[model samples]
Target: EPEVTQTPSHQVTQMGQEVILRCVPISNHLYFYWYRQILGQKVEFLVSFYNNEISEKSEIFDDQFSVERPDGSNFTLKIRSTKLEDSAMYFCASSYRMGGELFFGEGSRLTVL
Candidate 1:
């Protein structure tokens, strides 16, 4: 089966720095999302994108966060100013349709100091 893939499996950065997490979702999937798990916490939704625009976003996705489909197959999340609280495993997911079964990437672990 096809899968979503994330880059820099692990990244360490300082607070206030910028971080960009990259993802390549399954070619045929139409919906993409970004979720985060803070160590021991449950996965929390951040944002969802479709048709090259944001479909929805959580409160946690503030001005500091942005999502873009820079190209046909690449989706990305950018944290303009990383915060200590932002340290978490960021997952990239894709689904064929809204509310459909999701396939997640292994995750990119972000460590903010």
Candidate 2:
């Protein structure tokens, strides 16, 4: 079965530094999303993208954060400035049907120092 893949499985960044996490979703999937989980906390939705535009975003997607699909296949999430609170396991998910099941990546762990 196809699955989402993320690069740089683990990343460490200094506070105030910028970081970008990359992912490639399953070829047949349409809906794409970014979600994060702080250690020992619930997974929180960050943003959803479809048809080359942002479909929905949560409060956590502040001005300092952005997402883009530079090429049709790869989706990237960039954080303008890293903060201690931003350290978490970020997951990339995709689904063939909107509002349907989402297949998630192993996770990209971010550590802000």
Candidate with top lDDT is: 1
Looking at model 2, report the run of 10 residues with the lowest lDDT sum: 94-103
Q: Please, what are the lDDT tens digits per residue for candidate 1 over residues 7-85?
A: 9799999999999999999999999999999999999999999999999999999999999999899999999999999
lDDT of 2 by residue, 3-103 (tens): 89998899999999999999999988889999999999999999999998899999999998999999889999999999999999999999999778999
Model 2: C-alpha RMSD to truth?
Answer: 0.8
Q: Which stretches of candidate 2 lie over 4 Å from their true place?
A: none
Q: What C-alpha lDDT values do all the predictions have?
A: 0.96, 0.95
- lDDT measured at residue 63 in model 2 versus the true structure, 0 to 100: 95
Clashes of each: 0, 0
lDDT of 2: 0.95
Models, CA RMSD each: 0.8, 0.8
After aligning candidate 1 to the native by TM-score, how far in Å is the CA of 103 from where it should be? 0.6
